[model samples]
Target: MIEELQDVPAGVVGTRVSGRVTADDFRDFKPAMDRMLDAGEVRIIEVIGPDYEGFGPGGLLADVKQGFSTLTHMRAFKRTAVVTDKEWIGHTLHALAWMIPGEVALFGMDELDAAKQWAAG
Candidate 1:
């Protein structure tokens, strides 16, 4: 599941992902992101909880579709902060950051506050 995080700085979108992420979750998530992007360039903070069980098949497809749709607007993002304790998730984000137009940082779950601060900047 995915739920929006409140009380973030302006122009920043925050979300927490846990349990099994489904297409339904993305359906709920995309609008919030679009709203942020529509306003102007934005930063993102994603917190992956220990209960996160990865994405469902439909969620994967939704993610791919979102990726293609946002490919041209990648520069609209200023920063992305991923908070996760999983080493593999951190490595994956690090590798993917090379292709992203903005700065992407990975922080341990314990550093969620730091991640939020960096993303809000």
Candidate 2:
């Protein structure tokens, strides 16, 4: 699930994705993400740690829908730092980084602080 994280740097929206992410997770988390998007600029820190079990089908669909529906909002993405130990996630994000309008970086789970610093920058 996408559980919000606190104590992050200013202007950074931090979240942790763990366990089986279901539709309910997004239902509860979308508002914060929407608010970030509405602000017209986004510096996001996504920490997908060892506990992450991938997203449920519904959650995946919701994510895809939200992303595709706001293609223009890609420009609002200032920086995205993904902190994870998952190899697949790192590969996927690396492959898709070019599609994002801003910097997209991958960090080891232990480097969350560094990720936050990069995102906030």
lDDT of each: 0.84, 0.88
TM-score of every prediction relative to native = 0.92, 0.93
Per-residue CA lDDT of model 2 for 1-121, tens digit only, reads: 7889997998899999989988888889989988898889999999998988988869889887777866878788899999998999988998888877788899998898899999999
Error of 2 at 12 (Å): 0.6
At residue 63, give the lDDT of candidate 1.
Answer: 78
What's the lDDT for residue 31 in model 2? 90
Clashing pairs in 2: none
Residue 37, candidate 2: alpha-carbon lDDT: 89
Q: For all the candidates, what are their Cα RMSDs to the real structure?
A: 1.2, 1.2
Give the range where candidate 2 is weakest over 10 consecutive residues by summed lDDT: 63-72
How big is the positional error of residue 67 in model 2, measured in Å on the Cα after superposition? 0.6
Give the clashing residue pairs of candidate 1, or none.
none
lDDT of 1 by residue, 1-121 (tens): 8899996777788898998888888888888878977877979888898888898859889877877878768778899988998788878877788876688888888898888889988
User: Which of the numbered candidates is closest to the native, going by highest TM-score?
Assistant: 2
